[model samples]
Target: MEEKIHITDFLVIKNAELEIKQINVLIGPQANGKSVIAKLLYFFQGISTEFLKGIRSQLSKRELDKAIIDKFESYFPKYAWDGTGFSIVYTINDIQIEIHGQAKNKTKTKLSLKYSEELKKLYTAKKRIFLEKINDNQLEEEPLRGRGASEASIYRQHILVPLRTSKYSDFFSDPIFIPASRSFFANLQKNIFTFLSSNVDIDPFLTDFGSFYERAKALFKEDIFIRNSNDKQLIKNLYKAAEKVINGEYEYKDKQDWIISTKGKRTNLANASSGQQESLPMLIVLCVLPILKNPNLPKAQALTFIEEPEAHLFPSAQSLIVSIITELSSTFDLKFFITSHSPYILSALNNCILGSEVLGKNEKSTERFQQINNGSGAPLDFEKVSAYTIMDGKTINIIDSEYKMIGAEMLDEVSDHFQDVMNNLLNME
Candidate 1:
């Protein structure tokens, strides 16, 4: 699949064609459909072999269709729909998979799978997903429901990390989400675990972070966080990044169940400072990526979505965290889709872009990179990074092919306004 996702009138998203890259950054004002776009990508990427195979077990095509619709409603919420519905299309290689969901009833959703002309000639059903209801599920070849093993396999290879703490583990393994409100993790565990453990048919978008935190914590046993890394320096870089985020270093003590040690002081996650709490889960998740799967190859791609990593952090730490992500992206072959509202984050990214350009000419970028990167590792590869800002109901790409930022007026204006305010105060003196 080409890393681009085309969304048409899905909820608040009127029409969007996002060309996602290895490091895609979405920076926009709140409630402008940024999260919606991320969630849509999550859902689409998650429509994998396991998901399709699960639907195949259903007795009727109607039941399968209903199941898919219900999943979408729960995953994305019906209220986001602006009554116009949505048409999402993904073109993988030459085969096309299109999903049309009407915001109204939602039950009126349609999914079509079209193959290339040459491939169409061989398949019994050129375009699977016949609107005609097949009476018997067993006899009706899966083409009736746009089912294909190869296509599912193609999608399943791509992973998505939506990073919404609430529904963290709904699709993936346990402990998927690490929340921004991690400081209150202790209280959250009590409430969220109760909800997750219950039989209630809650929405998938609704998650209990505490429950997922416990799950994520469980994955840390037996050097699993440091499993198969031949790169000692890379692992060191990861720790160095983690150390920069937290004011100090921390380790998970499995025996006490999430007890953390920092500067020889022992405390639970709740007792830790806000920055420590915020950075703890992120630090662990970053280290754990290499160990998430075994026999780790150099080419494996891991897609992770991180929401507002700057939460509870100072400006310096914010820049450090972004650089750490940059280092990890190159180290682990990770594809990060981050959503942020932090000016520090944007400025740090800007520094990275500039740093890459200067480094290409062999001029020393250490000072420039270190200042913007807040003392982190290698500069970010701007070519792999695509940044977009949502304004007036549109996600606009800020950088061009040469990594020149086009729409930075809003950030500049804010800084100018701050300077003007400072000058006004000085004038009184």
Candidate 2:
């Protein structure tokens, strides 16, 4: 089954349906619901993580439902209502999950979530059998006496272990959402978690992203971040490309992030340029991906949602960042949902898709193409990519079928309008 998400009457988004792909990109003007779609996908794809935890803690169905509702509310504040309600249907593999809500008292939203019946049955059956064994004293009794860490461990062994390897596993891999406000966390450094704890009203998504960023940064405390031998060279190239994007190599020294420039000048993160601050957290995560491990879903493909990767970046730098991300995706077998408002980002991705086509035809042109792509191996299969423009409460495909590239018309719209204004001024003169 095709993976996709359909949203209707959701906040600023009147109606939008996106066909999810390996390299999904949404590009349009600001506040056109790009981030809304990204967050919805993040919330749904991450359901597996929460569901497993609910089962591990032996939560009743009613408790689990309330927990999920609360979690959803945390990601999306109650103020996003549009005087009505919304519906979201996210389909992945064999699962068709629906989230429908109704507005109440002009301030509250009542939500009802429906997922695959198989999952519900599985959860119930597992819980029942585990409880039966416990009642019969067929399992270890000491762990049950405390009902603490040991009991949780037993529950994991009985339920979570099988759930991880079951057919539902693919439906439940982690989705990392890197918000546009990521630089805020970078500026705070180690104090980010502390800040989040003190400020309880911050966006839950941003808070979670801050926590993930902290963990990613922690991976670099050791001498090496890449533990896989086969991927060492590829991961190293990723770091080199990332350095070019931020215009400096990142160093974790004295418990602070430092940027060491090519000219031998050193500046800590707080003192670095805004561009560096905006781009460093993302670059760090990309560079450290090789070492990041998930024991539960060890073989699942990683899904990442990045908002405005071009923030505070030069046009050329934006292109380089796109190349680095595309190359990293290809190298790590990861999938990305990226939101951007930059034409340069689209142009860069077009180059990647075209590079893949050109190199596939002529192996002899490898070195030349490498030079053009800045040695980032910036080649992406066009078939694996999907580009969309969200505007006027609608989603439109911006890829040109014949050219096998993102349509130049879409990327040149703003430039063309400005060019017309220039022509008019010249005529007046």
The TM-scores, one per candidate, come to 0.73, 0.89
RMSD of each: 8.6, 3.2
Query: Which candidate gets the maximum TM-score versus the true structure?
Result: 2
Range of the 10 consecutive residues with the lowest summed lDDT in candidate 1: 160-169
- Candidate 2, residues 215-287, lDDT tens digits: the string is 8877753455465445777777777878888787788878788889999888988878888888889888766
| Candidate of highest lDDT | 2
Kindly report which residue stretches of model 2 are placed more than 4 angstroms away from their true locations once superposed. 104-108, 126-165, 190-200, 224-228, 293-299, 364-368
What TM-score would candidate 1 get against the native?
Answer: 0.73
How many backbone clashes can be found in candidate 1? 2
